[model samples]
Target: MSAYGFEIVQTLIVDTEPDEYVKRAMSKINAAESNYLAGLVVGLRDSVLAFSMNVPGTTSKDFLGMVLVTQYFVTMKEIGALSESNPVFITHGPGTVKDIASQIRDGLLQVNTTQN
Candidate 1:
C-alpha cells in the first residue's frame, strides 16, 4: 500500500440555517483557490443544523474524527509496512496501530449508530 499526504489548510464549521448556510458555504469553497473541498451538513434532533467544510485536500474526510488513518495504518501493518511495535495516534494516546484499528472502527460504528 502507498502512503498519501493531504495538504488540507482550512476548516469551517457553521451552525445556522441550512438553506442560507449551504449557499454561503459553497460560495466560499468555490471562491477559494484550493484544488479540493468537501462539505457535510448535519441536522440534530433539536432542529439545530450545522455545516462543515474542509478545504485544500484529502484530509477533509476526517470531519468529526470519524474517518481517520487508523484503518490505513491497519492495512499497512498487514502488508508489513508497519510493525506491531509502531505506535499510532489513538483516542487519547499512542497505541499499536495494527491492534487499535479494529477497536476504533467498532467504536466509530457505535457512535454513528443513529441515522436519520
Candidate 2:
C-alpha cells in the first residue's frame, strides 16, 4: 500500500448549539494565521461539526499533526450535550480512505459504547 503523507480521512458534523468550548477554539483559530490547515472543526453547543482536509506529502506532516490533535482536544472539550463521551479522530492509509465513512461511523459507535 502506498503511504499517503497527510490527508484528511473524514469529516463529522454534529448539529447543535455553539458553546464555550467551541467559542474558545474558534476564537483561537480566527486570532491567528496558522501555517497548518485549521478551522475545519467548528465547536457549537448545539452544532458541533468537523471536516477533514487532506494535506498531501510529508512536508508539513509534523506541524499538521500537532495542530489537528490540538484542535481535536479543544473542540471536543466543550461539546456540551454531546459531551456524553469523548470524540474520536481516526487516521489511516490511502488503502483505507475509501472506507473512511464507515471507519468514522465505527469510531463514533465505539465512542458511544465506551460512554456506556
Backbone Cα, N, C clashes tallied per candidate: 0, 10
Q: Indicate the TM-score of model 1.
A: 0.23
Q: What is the RMSD of candidate 1?
A: 20.7
Report the Cα RMSD per candidate. Answer: 20.7, 22.5
Residue-level error in angstroms, candidate 2, position 31: 13
Per-candidate TM-scores read 0.23, 0.22
lDDT tens digits by residue: candidate 2, 17-98: 7898999999898667552334433332112212233443434435444445555555545563474656655554444443
Each prediction's whole-model lDDT (CA): 0.50, 0.53
Find the 10 residues in a row with the least total lDDT in model 1.
Answer: 40-49
Error of 1 at 25 (Å): 15
Tens-place lDDT per residue, model 1, 1-116, is: 12566665665865655788889998888767343432222232122212233333434234424334544545555756545555544443345543465667687788889551
